[model samples]
Target: MAKEHSLDLIAIGRSCADLYGQQTGGRLEDMLSFAKYVGGSPTNTAVGAARLGLRTGLLTRVGEDHFGRFIGEQLAREGVSTQGVIADPQRLTALAFLGIRDPDTFPLVFYRENCADMALCVEDVDPAFIRSAGAVLISGTHLSQPQVFEASLQACRIAREAGARVIFDVDYRPVLWGLAGRDRGDDRFVAHEGVTARLQEALPLCDLIVGTEEEIHILGGTTDTLAALRAIRARTDACLVCKRGAAGCSVFAAAIPARLDDGLTGRGFAVEVFNVLGAGDAFMAGFLRGWLRGEPLEVCSDWANACGAIVVSRHGCAPAMPTWVELQAFLRGGDRPFRLREDAALEQLHWATTRSGRYDELMVLAVDHRSQFEELCRQTGADPARLPAFKALALRAVDRVAGGDPRFGVLLDGRYGMRALEAAADHPYWIGRPIELPGSCPLAFEGSADVATELASWPYNHVVKCLVLCHPDDADELRERQERQLLRLHDAARKTRHELLLEIIASRNGQIDDHTVSRAMQRLYDLGLRPDWWKLEPSDSAAAWRNIERTIAANDPHCRGVVLLGLSAPEEELAASFRAAAQVPIVKGFAVGRTIFADAAEQWLAGRIDDAGAIDDLAARFAALVEAWRAARTHGAPADREIA
Candidate 1:
């Protein structure tokens, strides 16, 4: 297929933003908070297929607003081609507000009054884009409108001309067809001959037709399942897949069977359902993932059912779609948990695979010191208010050293370095904010007891850094307390969509065994706390680094590599440490503070150096450290620039 086509599938239809109510088992009217996600059937399918390693694209129109740009950016991040996605300047992006009141009741409100997705016109359909895909997927919602109906039909014609398969997902929505009230957006079907006739026009152009029983009833003009299948059979020779909810699904590629299960069938999971909103889209995506590869019908059905089951057990659709890794794990046939979302390993893979970023080499500056700054101010008798400007100056030094580089990051705190964080966030620099209170033995957040609430005001780009001085040999009570705190912070990070970077040291008072630090990491993973990045102190030997990396790889292979933390060591010692670290591939880079800026900051605070001198000194020191790191990673001679 790759030799003949550039893409596996092209999904054409509505695209919109979904704002889901956060209050589960609560009425939509009483919901307090919400989370935004990119939604719509074809958009979800494209994202689901892309996450399963399929080359897919979307053909739709979004409003020329923040949500529109957001949809485009998110699709691109999900590995779906957005070249065919156009923006309609005259309309606002569509939005859906949904709530889960019970297992069966999902109250939804769709804000799509002349929305952007419905603005897709015939002129927006590109023949080449449709032809390059192995198949084209057109949802039934787009056929309800005049302009988009013509555009979807044109795409089908192009696909037919190019010998590429055309797939029709009979995504029947009664409210969308004007058969229900505006507030009844969740209505599945209505006995409307007009809507069925409109859908029949597009069915004959399809090579594969997928729909639920009610949807087939809408398409085939009958309430009886077999009669509806026969009616659809008479219109086209395309394969028919009838979803049977929790009973699984049946696939009939030839004649209609005497009974539904008499045809080829795939078994479904016996797990409980949460929200049945996006399961059908997930089912179609899973079907195409196998169907495009020319797999057997039974295999495709199994994948389809499993995908649907997975999504039905989760909250949001696009974000809840299972990746290839998670699918494989679930299909292994074992005594499984009651809910797929409760599987730690599966959830970890989902979080890791869906994350969007690249930090091949993260060279971050460590300036998120709180207690140290206070001590410096106390010693120098300088006003505490000067610290914000000092931190801003520190950022300027980093800017002069490395401007707008994604690899260069700084760790700052909101208590003192909020101004610097505001400035650094505007550029492309990777930024991290520390939340752990300084000198807290068992660990505590710097501000409110509710860490998650405190992290709400942070920007999305700012990573959450927590310094834990945990020793494996510590008393069990103390260790348990520390682990509990770590779990809370980890949950907060996930809730806020911020990456967590754990600085795991044996103890700040002195050096414990290097092995103890590695053991601490393993224990954290056992608690189901998988941090994205690990910040560790430099090891004395290469073997220690190997063991540490092995522990991380075994627990969560998707873990971002480790960063070497500078404990304000001497310049010569740090240079030697960097050279030795070159022997380990897991160390991405270093996050050093005192080694690069301690002496310079001290001199500036003592009035021994002006601001310009301090900036010049910090920049040169940082640049030299960066060069030394490059040399170590590249097998070049160790750099000789002095910092002390």
Candidate 2:
């Protein structure tokens, strides 16, 4: 292998979306919805390697559709290079709809029949880019088609010629071959002489080969597992890994003899099985991590086993792969009190480490309160048609803060702020949109299920900010239902690939204080609602913030940090609150709605203030808050004081 390469690994072939039904223990026909996640073996492996802190890239073709965009964005988010992931404008991206009918049977249907991935041609293969990789991983399915087969071989040959190791993942999928009219039923694994011949040609060039027993059997042209291993060994001296589900795995390198009970084997981490579909891809990713890092054979196997164990017990393919920290934590201890599959800490670690872009601390402008603006219009005797103008004020504020301050975003709604959102979409600025009704104490959504539908239509850049009017003192039934709804919203946000910014407001009917807000947040955390950012009411004291921070750290330290909310207070009052919030390091910035725009909006609605005047006033108010926040963040927290 080359001593230096631009990429640690470049994975080639199929990329698709895996929509796994959340309703487990049911038929696909009975399921109402499925969770969308990035799928395809090579794509998963690339993402997994990237998650393990490897500089990886993917070589594949995805349709010009949203699913293809999602796959690209997801890869980029995981720090995987997508230079070779071509966007085929004519074809649709492949999809795999899977359902967990039981522990053993996972109902899967492939939607790839002449899909974008299958159309991969040698013309699409960039030889120079392939040569830059330390290793090139060729997926077995890529060899099913003549064009993709040629492309895969071309890339592999180029990488090998450049002193790059060629790794072959025998990711045998009978359904894919069947689509090519080469195989029968996907469930029936038969060793085709032609397929074996093609695989054998690539095996001689591989430095490493990983596969399940079935995959190995196909490549070695035998049903007997041992015979297959021997045949493969005779053909090439490449290190071979055989993945045995739950029994761990066995590694057969040049130095070790393969046996049932010996030769560089590692025990698999025991996990409660949920789905076993993507375990192999996760295993390959883990193995690549250890191999590239020059870990011992046993350690590499352990890493592979750990990754496989974690993914098998989770939901989807690439998303289920563990981060480096999560893997280390799993290796150190078993899933313990909180199962590793569902551990919030591990989830947060993935969230924190897998950031796609780097941005400075946020300075958000809140303009997403739909009902509040309507109420203001009603009180001021102005037509509701003027709401868009009111929202434009917030956009104007955002424009004013643009170049001068880099860390600014606006929280607007599609209802009143569609223009603002469309405009912001053209620029590279942070944007948050509310998905809840204004003053529903029980946390009713403004459009209920339609909120998710709206979210689906939005660009990936917008944040889904849901305002749940929470009260610790609310009835248990209401609290439980609210929790359920928020959980649904959280899942929907994840489906749409939007960063959730959960805004929680403690009910003023009770003694609305920091303690109440803290408890409310804790309750949600207990319910497993970990948002990327928390839009919180400003705490009265530093002690209150400390309490909230403790809960956040324990629950999800990967949280993007909290932002103070303005309850339509005066500029001075909001400034005082900003000072207190800025003292807390966990507080990134503020999202003040009324304090900045309510009065100006009201005056504009009443025709007392012109568009320029209203925009100017809103800009000035927003600027004042920004100044206060920047000063507070710079000078540090002030002395502790009691709330008046």
Candidate 3:
């Protein structure tokens, strides 16, 4: 297998829609809705391998419907080559409705009769494409149908002739095989001699075979595990891998003994399990990732186990797969205790790092302050009419700071001042719009009562920023109400595909300590609020920032890094904060409002400075902050430059 080749692995099998029930720990009858995600053994493995940095492709058929289109889109998003995946307008895509019973059990019903995948024919198989891949993996279910079986065998022959390794994943599902006199009670280990004989015909052509213990039982035509291993060994000289859930997986080379004790075992990671359905696919993808990369068998097993551990602790199969960086981070995280909330951050990293052309770092302009702007208006006794001019002045500051730098975003409230938001809409600058009401105690929205409904209409590229004034020590009733509102906002943001920025301001009256802000973050995660970005205040110490990072990892590993809030700090002090924040990798950018635009805004409002003069001052201040932030990132030093 040459690394220079285009495709590393091409998977052939079923591709379907997995309707996973949203309500955990409940039966399907009790669930009202299910989140749609791409599923199927081969598809999941392909997606997982792609996420782990493999140049992968899929050779399967999907229906002409949206589910099929969704599967194609997801594969494309994950960087998988979908040129081989055909669309069958004659048949619909397969579907599986899944429900979580417990950590060890998940109930699933397969609705795949004359599905598109089963309709695959010999004519659909691309010989040249299969030959180009370093390896071709075929799922066992493909052999159940005579037409698809012929196609699978043809792909295998073409791949083998081209010197590509042939791998078989015995994804044995008893219900899919219609054999009379079969004990339907046991779906795991159903032994039929006819099926075993049929599977054996393809075994001699395989260089590698993978299956769970029960799957092996069916493939070997024996209930005894050891007898099954021996039977497989006699049939083929291929490498065999036995998947043991939570106990990890074992690999046996052709020269190895049939017994499990003789095979190489990779210790499994100990983590809280939410669903066990997709763990096998994740493990297979991980194992192949290591094997295809020419890594040692032991290292492959470790990758397999770690990958499986990550999927079991989350939701859907393909979406839950970790990228190479996330896997490395998890392995490097050591024996430390990990919570499920923290997995979101890693998931974010997995999704973010795999994509092309993301900003290396961001230098966002902070103009999303409504309460402070109103306060300035109050202090100067200026009419609220002048606020629009002030906001217009802030736009000039954004333009100056963001000049020639694509890594800049502006946060402005559309409710208070629409001028800035409208001006920056079609501009190159990244825009984030605030949805929270000005000076709300437990949080309130200015427009429609439902913040989610209002935000649903916002542009996709515009980030929805929510500013919440919360305290860890707040009264229980107020905290509960706030949590409910925040969860509603979170659900809406996810459904609308809008990136969210959560700005949490600790209650001003409470005794502020290092742990206060981080604990506030953890509380939101506990209530199911996973924001893409967290707008935070400058921390007092290095240890405090580390605690915040840990908190982000636990609650939402997918969280974009935090941005430091100005809290109306003096320009010199805010500069120092930027230097401190740049030292933290988890701090990607800054969003400081008053420190950048306050002085100019006050001068313009009080009639001490003209409109042009105020605009110039604001732009200079904003540019100075941008310079200080870049310097802090490039050179490790405090922001010592005076504000001109």
Candidate 4:
């Protein structure tokens, strides 16, 4: 039987009231539209673990004010035991102002002057709590303050003594420790230099060290991820896990070599991102989940990838976390198809130009018989001249799916003898184009390099290559051939200073084995090409949709939008409730089939949907419906109505 208090994760240090303001192209003093959310690295980790069904507790200090109450309540609601959370009546809670300029990054300003969290002393932490937990997790941020820092260190020591593993997250913030206080002279440069020194003090005691590439560099003074991991590992017996953001995570343990001879060492999974905030915490939560379950290091990396993927695909931190059911569903290939709106489409075009690195652009080439190609083009409203460019554009589109940005163009042609395009239909870069084959012609293009280079040169930060083979005889051959083409494309794209994405799509029900696809993908990994690939049957789409619908329906308050056969009262109710709970506008709409419905809904929600030249007509309609309901309720009130 599992222990009575099995696998309790105790998270300590640093709590803050994170105030976020959306930039509306105005000055900082203009009183921008702002939103407040509770934030703290430890708080986030605790909540993340709890959401994953772990017995978790948070030990931190907040002020006696309303913000402290809010933080306590938020943790409690997330199923995190806040018994160890203390309120400091003498000091105020820490405050951090976060400004979101884009989904990938944000600007932060901290206002923590002797904050309550910093007032935490060694006597505050309950020894029983430390002894009961399976692991005690702490962050390096608290080390800036002596009292709180000592308290956190002592707690970790106590937990370790009580037979609990110690997990240290080196979340280094230069500004926090950069201030020229009395004890440390006016050496302004000391703040940045002090981070590594402080981290070194805590390294020997930590059982595990989790950090990003940047954090690793700051801590170990090295840019190379592998070298940093080894350097840190040599100092402590702790396992070193370095997060590479979009590229995935690299894990190193003493028993395990840095690289495998069979080339099966660092595991990776490409993720679709919306906001990168709290992604590290999500990854830590995931890694801890696997570690608690006694899973292998590789599986642990996969969990971290899955958790980080889910968190970054949403807006906020705690609210964005997926439940255990949602994670399992996603792992089981139950994610819905990509959807796009006009604004997202335009943003993709803009993002393509502004961002640089990987091909943020996607290209989808649809191949099918004559009748299928013609019918698909007619249904999708794709143009014939743009058919050749559609494949590259669609591949770019898939990268932006997490942002709900529509960025691909569709085309229809009858040049190839195939019926429809052989591409992932749900891929963002796929343009829903279907080309009819004229007869057996040259399937391989002599100037494929030119096309590949042009596609790679798009303005997007990341480039993705998607290949879908619908022809039975062409599947195996196409898979190998496409890999070579992608490598060449990747080389060309890199020459132009862009990141290349090469994805292969196959049917799950087909003769192809998943291990074969994994092995093929592993080869790409060896070439430093980490791409997203999927193998699914035709009916997999419906199953994915059903899973999404169920998730939306069950978590109504958390679900921001609903896609059904068409807009209905049920969807409206869900949207209304989500808006009320999250305190943000909610979207309610539907897609007819996979393509048509998703496109329309994406545009409508993004305020780009046009019906009779009216932007957000569907959204306005829903708003009106909600307004009328409010009016009816107001009118239904009897005179005086003072029974209560």
Q: Report RMSD (Å) for each prediction in the order shown.
A: 2.2, 4.6, 8.0, 18.7
Give per-residue CA lDDT, model 3, range 323-440, as digits (tens): 8888898888754445543555565565455433354577676767777778888988998777766786677767766775667878877756688778876567777888887778
For candidate 2, write residues 230-259 as lDDT tens digits: 899898999988888888988888643545
Per-prediction tally of clashes: 0, 0, 12, 47
Ranking by lDDT: 1, 2, 3, 4
lDDT of 1 by residue, 1-644 (tens): 53488898999998999899888997899999888889999999999988787999999999999999989989988999998999999999999898888988998888889998898988999888888898899989889999999999999999988888999999998888788998888888899989989999987899999999999999999999999999999999999999999999999999998999898988988877989988999999899989988899999999999899889988898988989888887888677688767776777777887888777787877888988988888898878788888788889898888877878888888999999999986677889889999979889888877999888878777889999988777788888899899999998898778899999878663466647778888989889899999998876577777778889888888988888888987766777778777677778998889877787777888789989998998888888778878877887873564534
- Across 1-644, the per-residue lDDT of candidate 4 in tens digits comes to 53455447989888888776545333334536455667888888887777777899888889999899889877876778888889889999988766544543455667788898888899998888788888899897888788878898899899878777899998866667765443222121322556667777888889888887778876775665566566676678888887877667767676435552222234444544555777788888888888877888888888778788767765556655656655665566433433111222222222232221122222222222233334445666644433333322333233333233332322322243112233333333323222112321212323233744454324332333233333233455655665565556555553443433232333421555424333444445455442221221221133333443343333332322321221122434433332322221221222212222233333433445334322233223433333333332345433232211
Model 1's number of clashes is 0
Which stretches of model 4 miss by more than 4 angstroms?
Answer: 1-7, 23-31, 179-193, 255-272, 334-644
Question: All candidates' TM-scores?
Answer: 0.95, 0.85, 0.67, 0.51
Error of 3 at 505 (Å): 11
Candidate 3: deviation at residue 433, Å?
Answer: 6.0
Least well predicted 10-residue stretch by lDDT in candidate 3: 179-188
